[model samples]
Target: MPPKAEYIELKKSIDTLIEEVATVKEQQKTIMALVEQLDQTQADNLEKDKKIAILENRVADLEQYTRINDVIITGLSIKPRSYARAVTPENGGEPAELDVTSTERQVAAFMQSKDIQLDCNNIEACLPLPKRGTNGKPSVVLRFVNRKHKIALLKQGRKLKGTNVYMNDHLTKRNADIARKARELRREKKIQQAWTANCKVFIKLNGTPENTKVLVIRNIEELNEYDV
Candidate 1:
């Protein structure tokens, strides 16, 4: 071939290679930018997950604090007030519906009967909780004027062991479920005892006095961690 034609073909081949190299470099830059963006997104998602976990823990703490002054009394039947009933003709009166009294009075009287000595004035509110099923009596949820009053009532609750009534802390649904699981663990001999205080479930594992494990249940996963 002629020298000039060969030089022209070589120059064209060099230019094409340079263009392909530039295109490849551009693609590499684009790929690097995308990788950096994906890395940042992953970091942001991890940080967000951490923040969400922290917020959830804070919310759980706040929920527990709100229940500090609450207590539940179960198996306390509502008693009829002793008073003269007015005869009425609203489809034959029937003792005027047992002369219903204020809930505070009823709760105070019930606690007094149980020897808990709770003052009516110290009770902030009292109401009957909805019955769970068809048979058992509805429980009474009582809010006290202060945490100390609630604590005192709980401390005195042990006296009602042989009686027909029982008392417990007013726990949130999550804590209540945890407490139930803890109790189940105790019944299965996985723990010595399970109890709730201040809306937290506690477990006592069987061990020597020095090694006896007492754990506060913050999540259900903790139950699976126990070797028992």
Candidate 2:
């Protein structure tokens, strides 16, 4: 009611309002700091993921490089009876049946028949893969002493298309799965052609090599890049 009493009451109200404003400013500062920390954490996680991806790719490249000198031959006629028989050397040496080189010699002979310049000496190692079922002959997985020999065989393999003999580059399991899926895509009419060369998978969506762009499939996920 009096001027002095009214002035004191207004001063008290102003002080209370100032305290509430200060509290709101402090809360705003705390919220902004939390948001900044979250942004930094996300950026750090993204950097870590990129590094892991780079390391994985390098390991895959090394695995493929080791298999560059290997190839697999399927549909070769190798009888089970002669599977353990010894093979005589070209120099007219004794029949070395205990050595179990009959398969190697047979594979060497088969390659020669195809006009691919190779011999038992060129074969660094040879092992017959188990036959899928009871009927067909087992596929031969072989490594060459020289990379050139593998390349020569691959180049000459195209002529054996109509015949039972088939050859393919030896690929890592990851790459093999990718190749298998690529071929499946081709058979499904989703792609023009898909094959493996030097242990790398490739796909041609459509069109000729001149017009169409061929894609190299490094990982299986890349297969999804094509629309068809």
The TM-score, computed over Cα atoms with residue i paired to residue i, of candidate 2 is 0.74
The digit string of per-residue lDDT tens for model 2 on 71-151 reads 888888665434344556864775555544477877877777777766667889987888877786668888999988889
Candidate 2 versus truth, CA RMSD in Å, comes to 5.1
Per-model C-alpha lDDT, please?
A: 0.84, 0.82
lDDT of 1 by residue, 1-228 (tens): 899999999999999999999999999999999999999999999999999988987898799788789998888876544555666788486546444576667877777877777876788888887778899776888998898888888899887988778889988887888898889888888788899887788999988889998889887777886635
Error of 1 at 118 (Å): 2.3
- Local error of candidate 2 at 57, Å? 0.8
**How do all models score by TM-score?**
0.73, 0.74
Clashing pairs in 1: none
